[model samples]
Target: MMQRNVGVVFGGVSPEHEVSIISALQAAAALDRARYRPVPIYIAKDGVWYTGDDRLLDPAAYRDLDRIRREATPVMLDPRSYRTLELVAAGGRRFARPARWSVDVLLLGLHGGPGENGGLQGLCEAFNVPYTGSGILGSALGMDKVLSKMLCRDQQIPIVDFVAFRESDWGYHEEAWLDRCEQELGYPVVVKPARLGSSIGISRAADRAALDAAIEEALRYDEKVVVERAVTALREINCSVLGDVHEAIPSVLEEPVRSAGQELLSFREKYLRGGGADGGKHARRPAKQPAGAEGMASLDRVIPAPLPPEKTAEIQALGVRIFQLFECSGVARIDFLMDGTTGQVYFNEINTIPGSFSFYLWEPTGVSFTDLTHRLIDLALKQHHDKNGRVRTYDVNLLSERSLQGLKGAKQRAG
Candidate 1:
């Protein structure tokens, strides 16, 4: 049997570029050779696309990006056809030729911005190509924290109270808005950019002065900002969900332990090694655990989350609900914030394309990384097959007959 070609596209013009590279390389290395052929498509920080042996897994090689660019060959996907990802090669003393390579499916490892926030998904949809993760609407919704929270509210999913404001609104009525926020949500609020991830442009304000500063900080990253009541005694727990609108499954929950004086996991803590004192960097590395421990087996997670079975079930149920509500496909990691004392779980955010593809979470459930990648590729192919069967165009020529009649009516009305 012929192996399906899976194009894993990663690296982007997002703050999460380094994390995306780590996740993509991990996924590429885990693809089952017998069932699928993994093709690495690297997109540089400058938006250039490249594909070659130089794009293979090598963490140390990334520190010097200029060297990689010099060695790698340029590549691009043909928008005219979804089935092919063409390589643009320079011909000696002649015009460049378009060399094509067939792509059976797309495995997106993009983390934020254009890659995760519907831009790449929209491009794929334009070509009618099936890619893993959420569709355009779902991806957009998931990326925007404010919009996703609104949807969650409509779906009865519990989320922390938040106030959203546009940059223009803040600039025009700063004092009035500040008074309103203080009166309603009060101080000690969490300020975050509406669309960024990895805790970029996120800050906590303890008073009116701090609140003003936090909002200003957030505006630097995004035009829209959200202010919410901060969970001071917070326990960060995350669960991974898999499937589409009708069906979904949740992984075991894991608490992301933070270091002293760290209120939230910053981008530095997430990607930079040894950046923290309490081994925060090492916490992200892969780990081994006993059997039957579930998704928490591969990562440094306290198996079962040390919460009541009922509460654990509740979080998992909510994870499945959020996955279905957003119409997400393949896999996603849904994060939740629980009050350390009250056990009150509030929906934090959803990572449409999570780090390491959340493969570590599935390992404990007996799903190997290879199996997980294959599952996503199979889902993409199935979605493409189902979409092709739908009636996309009409046979009737309504424009042909209506053109003359419409023109005559328009001329009569104008006269």
Candidate 2:
């Protein structure tokens, strides 16, 4: 049984960079040793790419990222073959020989920004590399909060009332935008950067003053911002969907526990809470973790969500429906905001490459983290095969035809 090399891509020029590292490393650690070899492809905050087995695989090495990157090999893609993903070392390496590695599939652990947006997925498409999670279109849709909600609305999927605006619009028509939000969505709104995930740059504003501040804060993270009518009686629920939209299954729902005073899940609450020596007030972890360590699995949550069996089934069905609507492939986690009193479940957002791949949600469904990662790789390969099977290129060259000659003659005459 030859082992397939899996490149785990993470750590990007995003605010969630550290969290992406944790998610990527955890996924790498969970890869079945007998079946796959995990290769760490670390993208630094400055957009430089690095590769080092020791430096990347160990969580502690990231404590001093500058020194770690200095010790690691800077890598770039080999442009020789469009269909092959060959990683070669960049110049100015500490070692005389820079190692080159080949990967069968890419396991994306990126949390937000370009890494989770269509940018990275488009790169993968251009390279003809098989990557786990949603494809370019799905990723773009998932990242754009306004567009995603629009899609849901089109599909008759329930979502919370929201208004979206750009920084330019806010700056120029400040009173107009504020009036719209207040009139359409009202006060007690949730302000968020449209393209970010893991609850970064998300805030709940109760009145006009807080809404003004929240919108400003969110704009610092993204050009486009969304102000959603805050669900005062919000009960957040998340379900992970696996496989392609055509043939997929939903994992058990998990309700993430939020820290006090946090109306919405903050970055610290999502990734750092219950994570360190000081109860994760900061991500200041002790040097070593216990054996069988987990990342997102450590989040304080209730498995099966303590919901009625019927309600659980309903949410799972919606999860699958949304996954299919987005034409998502591989794995994605769809989060829902439920009105606890009314039992109304509204689609919140989708994480195309959810943190830790949402393996915790799958565990109770009889799938281990190892199995989950393996399936994601297998699904990526399947999607790649299907994509290549499509007719993407024209067989005949237009330059060789008489029509082209006529067009050229016409253009020359015009010139």
Candidate 3:
């Protein structure tokens, strides 16, 4: 069997930059060596692109990204090809020239910013290269908390009631906006940067003072901010959906618990909890992961979520419906907020390019990490083929059919 070159695109100018690196590295390491060869594509925080040997896939190597860029070959993806990504790089003063890499498909490991918010996906679409995860529409929609909530509500998908505002709104109508949030959502609302993930700019506000500060803090990260009524008895459940809109299945659910007084899952609790995080205090880890292996799985979580069989099945089915609704391909993790007291579930958000591709969730369902990566590539290829099968351009020569003199005369007459 021929091995396909899979370009694993990771890292971006987002708060979740490190998370992207971890997710991409984990996926690259787990890719099926027999079927696919992983090509590490790193997008620096400053938007520079680089491609190199396996060292780029190491989490430790990224500590000094400036040094890594100096050592790695600067490259760019060719936009004129389909199912064939040409990584073009010219010989420079210091490093030796390297051969161009022909990629069969792209495995996107981007978590936030343009990479996960449809910017990179649009580039792939324009280049006609097969790429994993949600397409432009889904990525853009999923990234916008305000828009996603509206769309889900339109589709009859249950979502928490919330309010959204832009930075400029607070500039003049600060008191008015605050009043609306306090009146509609009441006290104890969750404030978040509209288009960010990984709980980077998220805070729970219990009163007017906290709400004011939380909104201001969230605005620091994004122009738009959303405030949702916080679930008092919140049980955060996340389910991973694989495949595309046509045929996708859900993995077993996982519940992530927040530490006492944490209010919500802060960025600290999510990534900085254990195993080499800032102070080596990472979140709740359910299993002993191998050294250097990291991602969403490293965080504390309860697999299968301790939910009843019927409730688990219901959440899984809902995940599938969401995948199809968003026309998502590849794999995505749909997060839910379940009210422990009422037994009601509400759609919280969608991670189009979930950390580690949410492979850990699938492993319990008999799908290994290698198997999950392989399926994503297959789905990407299929989606690309289907897109190309449709009619794209017209072959008519209008200029040849109409004389310049006749066209001028027609235009003058119409005017």
Compare candidates 2 and 3 on lDDT and give the better one.
3
* Predicted structure 1: clash tally: 1
The local distance difference test score of model 2 is 0.82
lDDT of 3 by residue, 361-398 (tens): 99889998878888888888888999999998867543
List lDDT for all candidates, in order. 0.77, 0.82, 0.84
**Poorest 10 consecutive residues of model 2 by lDDT?**
283-292
- Of candidate 3, the 10-residue stretch with the lowest lDDT total is 279-288
**Tens-digit per-residue lDDT, 261-307, candidate 1:** 88877766555424322323224333321121111122334654778
Candidate 2 local lDDT, 128-183, one digit each (tens): 98888888889989989999999999988999999998998899788888889999
Q: What's model 2's lDDT at 68?
A: 60
Tell me the number of clashing residue pairs for each predicted model: 1, 0, 6
Kindly report which residue pairs in candidate 1 clash with one another: 294-364
All-Cα superposition RMSD per candidate: 4.7, 3.2, 2.9
Question: By TM-score, is 1 or 3 better?
Answer: 3
Looking at candidate 1, what is the lDDT of residue 242? Answer: 83
Clashing pairs in 3: 273-281, 273-282, 273-283, 274-281, 274-282, 284-300
On TM-score, the candidate that comes out on top is 3
